[model samples]
Target: MEAFLAYTLVVAALCSYANSQLVPAIVTFGDSTVDVGNNDYLQTVFKANHPPYGQDFSNQEPTGRFCNGKLATDITAETLGFTTYAPAYLSPQASGKNLLVGANFASAGSGYDDSTAALSHVIPLSQQLQYFKEYQTKLASVAGSENASSIIKETLYLIGAGNSDFLQNYYINPFLNKHYTVDEYSSYLISIFSNFVKSLYGLGARRIGATSLAPTGCLPLARTIFGQHERGCVSSFNTDAQQFNKKINAAASQLQNQLPGLKIVIFDIFKPIYDLVANPKKYGFVEATKGCCGTGTVETTFVLCNQKSGTCSNATDLHHSKEASDHVSLKQFDVLRYQQAGRSRFLNDTDKAVNSHRLLNISKIPRRRNGYEHQENNSKFLQDGTMNIN
Candidate 1:
């Protein structure tokens, strides 16, 4: 833990220095992966602002983040030199100078599709966009219109969504399955993604970093639901996810060409997550199939992972699982480092490095806090190893 904190401090110092000359704020939009605490403000079953949810977070207090600690977005914000964590748009903390740092519009269970969000009573992409507009008004009121515009233009917009679209909606809904095939559904999602990016561009966003879909089929819930017979990852679900990821990547390329002054980069999460799941031992993960919370198979939202639930002592063991508790700890640090670098070439370089499976001497890091450990190791790796974020 001491080594982890030391690494965090070092990276924080470096990022702080770099951020003084680069990004001024970070605005995030997405599902639970980046949703800080917006779901807590909503009257929905999808909330994590309770005991056992933040067992490893600072002070071990539940802060509405689905994970036991900070989400990738939270760590990204810190890496960008924002001492203050981004507040949820609906939370009282998202006012005054706090608006200058930015606010999180992500909600647990949200996706590109509105119906998917409706199932979990989460804030849909459209509603989140409306909230973004509201946030602009509030920002303008706090800072002058000119300054607000500057912040909007310079802010690093991090977006991560669409997981729930497959996990909680399409795959489970036989009605939708009857209407759309996997390919059709993936294309449909790409259309929504394209429109969402265009809308953000219309809102004065320029530096946008969107994450591609992870290996959802490898999730514990996927294994339980679709792989129950075989006791393995659902290949069909993973194939769909890969297809969706490809479409999103293609859309990102086209959007970059079509939208002028838009700097959009799609971060590839599939490879890193799939690598961790497929080779858990290589990454020092003993349990990649299940989460640390309760049964770790199906514990998500309010029903599962509650205060009474039995949580694993180490939150880091969770992996590509579907339970909200299932999270890849390494992702938080690596993704944050990539975003903080603010370089387009970083994605390609990092993808190659991750695919090559280069070890980073991070085995000593604790599971729950491995994000920081990876961040620390990533800094060194990026400097001298195959990965180069600069």
Candidate 2:
């Protein structure tokens, strides 16, 4: 599996370097919306640290991840050929050996603000970048400085964030509120992120992919908690998402112009996910409104999702263990607390759809040199962790 994953990474890197697709070594930043498990390291209570959260994952432990399965980062990594998970950079066991493999710096419940916007628990964008630096330094130390520098220069840097900034801080956050208006906030975030991207380039990141925020209004947590008893999603939230995405797209254009020779790209997570929600038929997804967990009651983010809790469906009643170390089999309910709450009736306007009116042309990107060429072309772009200093 590891070798297969590694091979996939090679291919994915080739494709991503093309600038039209995702690449290897996904370096993430942002909130629980995309956090892997940084919250597990922290003492904060705002986390998705329970079973059924990772029901689809191998270990099946909660581990503080904040998604039904893997988030967009995991899916992106899988496509790129990461043999297994992109290791958590902060994980003590990592010891920096996995630096070339890829790392996740995202924390659960985190946002653009120092304090969490909605859940009152999360790492801010600044901290996330700070951790990323630590990981890079550790890698430099382990890989004999020279090799580590080479690796960071060649590796693909992926960022998926900012929704928490808008939704939690600007829109619906209770404790930590927004200081700027939606337009001002979006500009502020993109501006900071623009500088942050330049910083990465300064630190030897030549390839980067920044994902725009998805439709927060359609997210289960947003729809339910901020609904004021309404079953459907809030429209204003989606509007914020659209505006934020437009800003990101614009910023990506500007950054690309500035970073010469570097392959910088933007992932349209908004369009893909929105399409899935709007026209489930286009994608193979059956449900998008709420997840298939809890008694259809908690939605897993706010409550436990356990089949043992009597909310699971009749199909696929298999058991798996909690921790990966112990291989003892447990009931399906014991691990994945997934429960089909039936098809969601609450949805955005089917008549007013983004995908229906839009035709996204497949953009082509230049594929970087494969591993062999990467080793050969170490001086031109992949030497001593130096970029944009050119």
Candidate 3:
């Protein structure tokens, strides 16, 4: 018993040491999935800082996050041991120590393609990068040169964009459809993504995680516009999204090879969201077709999901379609585990801590399917720290 106790103490010390060595900060960029009210400061109609939108968030006050509650990034910051939320880079609240913890430059309706953002008067990717440069200068003044450099190098960068490019620009705009086929358009976006990652690396960002496009064809807006005749998801659009995801995955590999001493991981949000939509009953979701807000059919942005819109008792039902409602079924805890697992994998090797990083671990990372889906092997989806780090 004494020997066992001694071994346990040693293990505890090692664990604590590892926790202490975690990335010092988190910086985010992207569209609505990670946007925490940067649009509120902008003049675009894509804003979401109103009642009912934050009915479920802390203090039940809308702070510009697109969702009714905390965004995935908000939860991610807390999981990383951050006591305070990272304020929007454009907000007055984003000053002093908040800049140290990190800042969010994401804008709703923004995407890899500038035209998409321009259509809605949102900040473009190029402009967001400029803000990041400005952030570096501010950070250096506050934390001093060396401390700011350390913060930039050791920070976890989360980026999620590209959805608006397809949903708002490519699919709806006849001009783009006339100029480029879906395959050609995807390649064009990948090129932009490649440049973005390279630019971030040049700015001293070492650890980066970029999210792939979600199943947009499954969104309520898509269904309303393209699938109204069939009254279902637009299969062609979903197919395009899958193709884009595949191209981005390849791009990530290429970026890792080209940029030395840089770590980039592409998080696969498509599969988990697709699974929820495909098998809603397996995930305890009853209404998979519509969101809990307004009509849940075509509601998005300021026009829909507003204070006057009818909200469901449970926000988890905020999927965009009956068949696609599974997209929003992803629990906050599930996403947190996936991110933690990715961080653990990348940070596992202390010797190469500053030199190398790992991508997502596909084998052990489990999706948040319903009880029925895991009935056969309850242990498979368990959130234990045993997830394989590849």
lDDT of 3 at 357: 42
The best-first sequence of candidates by TM-score reads 1, 3, 2
Better of 1 and 3 by lDDT: 1
Q: Which tens-of-lDDT digit does each residue in 171-255 have in candidate 1?
A: 9888677766778777766766777777777778876767777788887667766787565778888888878877887777766
Alpha-carbon deviation at 244 in model 3, angstroms: 0.7
Whichever of 1 and 2 has more lDDT, that candidate is 1
lDDT at residue 216 of model 3 (Cα atoms): 75
Error of 2 at 46 (Å): 2.9
List residue ranges in candidate 2 displaced over 4 A.
Answer: 1-24, 117-121, 173-179, 228-230, 295-390
* Residue-pair clashes, model 3: 6
Q: Could you say which candidate leads in lDDT? A: 1
Deviation in Å, model 2, residue 94 alpha carbon? 1.9
Q: Model 2: C-alpha RMSD to truth?
A: 12.6
In angstroms, the error of model 3 at 27 is 1.0
- Candidate 2 vs 3: which has more lDDT: 3
Pairs that clash in candidate 3? 282-370, 283-370, 288-321, 288-322, 289-321, 289-322
Q: How close is candidate 1 to the true structure, as a TM-score?
A: 0.78
lDDT, residue 348, candidate 2: 23
